[model samples]
Target: MAREVFDLSFSNGFARTLHERALGDIEQDYPWQSLEPSRYPPLLLARARVGWTENAFNEFCTAAAMGQMLQALVQARAPLDLIGMASRFAIDEVLHIELCARMAMRLGGGAPIHYDPEDIVFALDPSLTPLERSNELVVRLCCVGEALSFPLLSGAMRSASHPLSRSILETIVRDEAHHGKFGFLYLDWIRAELRPAERDRLGKAARQTLDAYRSLWERGPSHVVAGVTSEGFLLEHVRELGWMEASAYAELARVTIEESVRAPLARAGIML
Candidate 1:
């Protein structure tokens, strides 16, 4: 017999919140570092700086998505525990911004990052029903987006030599594990009620997200950011920094989806 994904009896027992012990205080536990400025090359430092900016932006995006999801859940009368978990997840994203920024400053210094406020808000077509909109958003952002972080960060951890970076990265990996699991669980909870059309909607969304990801990865490191194009950078020495080379990262991403993500979705009858 297959295991149940969503606990139908969740309300019977109290739902657990985030592991406060593991997380600790963002600043106190994950202390900032002051490494020798000369340790990293100019390009490497520049890349780290870019990482800070990108991760900061991603932090806000994820937080914004959390708010939208919470609103949708309330409108749909979702479990209070689930909403509580999401609220906490939004806080985690904030810590991630600090972690990323610290890494950048340690590497070199933070780059100028200007983000438009409008870009942070979530929007869906007027036609989408509450359930439909929420499902698609969760499927795209959490299921696909946060799910991918598992493999990507795991791969990085394996190659990462720096003790401080690895420690911080592990927290993100731990937190994202729950995020990905929630996506699958939520989908499973709604699985029996889903019409063929709803499944198709989610299936299409997943496919599109995966395709965009593959396309982005296949484009090489030059496609990663501006003024930073070390194509095979992560193949050797840079692996010390906890990232993969262009070819390896792309292949890893594709393989991980095929194994972990795509297979599971197909089994769940999502047709991805």
Candidate 2:
């Protein structure tokens, strides 16, 4: 017989409230103000230009994926509460795409906002059951993707010379944090319902999903930024922000996955 599932209403409510609160905190704290973009070297400015465009492209991909995943969840007849939370998250992601695009343009970079066909194809594959799809989606979207993104953005925000870029990154970080929390909570809720064998399977799947995206957080675009900036100053700035140190970032990944993804799952008796 199949294992019984529990209602995720409370988890959904907690996630919604957390996201809402994060949105408000972003409006209030606005942590990006410390970086004065104009103070950076000219080469650094050029790098920021490229970075903004790349950032916009990444956000567009993320938003597109989240929208598709949310649709899949709704189609699977996931609890209404979870569906509603996902709906709001999808909308926020869409707005983030637009916001990042605008920020790129404002920072003197042309928008490179092409959506990859593969992103949709991977997101909407009909081969997997709903639970399988959700697990894959959360592992990639929340745990690996958003989990790594926060620290990267925070680092960029710290090194940013442009005030607007700093502000934009700060806002984006707030949303990503909440998204990470949702991934954690979902893992917790699902782990409780899984049998030992299933837990092991999920753990392996989670680790594989995470390992697949390891390159995304590998290193700064040092060479690329060097070319764009015409000097190594931007690269140095990135180094100052700790992007050059793989050890530190690797540790960050380990802790983020452990605390925000693995630990919660383990506590709920999930193998991952």
Best-performing candidate as measured by lDDT: 1
lDDT of 1 by residue, 56-110 (tens): 6677678778778878877766667766776678877866766776676666666
lDDT of each: 0.69, 0.59
Give the C-alpha miss distance for residue 159 in model 1, angstroms. 1.4
**TM-scores, each model vs. reference:** 0.80, 0.66
| Count of residue pairs whose backbone atoms collide, per candidate | 0, 3
Name every residue pair that clashes in candidate 2.
36-161, 37-161, 37-162
Q: What is candidate 2's lDDT per residue for 51-132, written digit by digit as tens? A: 6566666676677778876866766676676667767676576556545655544445453334435644243346767876
lDDT over C-alpha atoms for residue 18 of model 2: 74
Candidate 2: where is the Cα deviation over 4 Å?
A: 1-43, 111-115, 120-127, 155-162, 216-231, 234-251, 269-272
Instruction: Give the number of the best model, judged by TM-score.
Output: 1
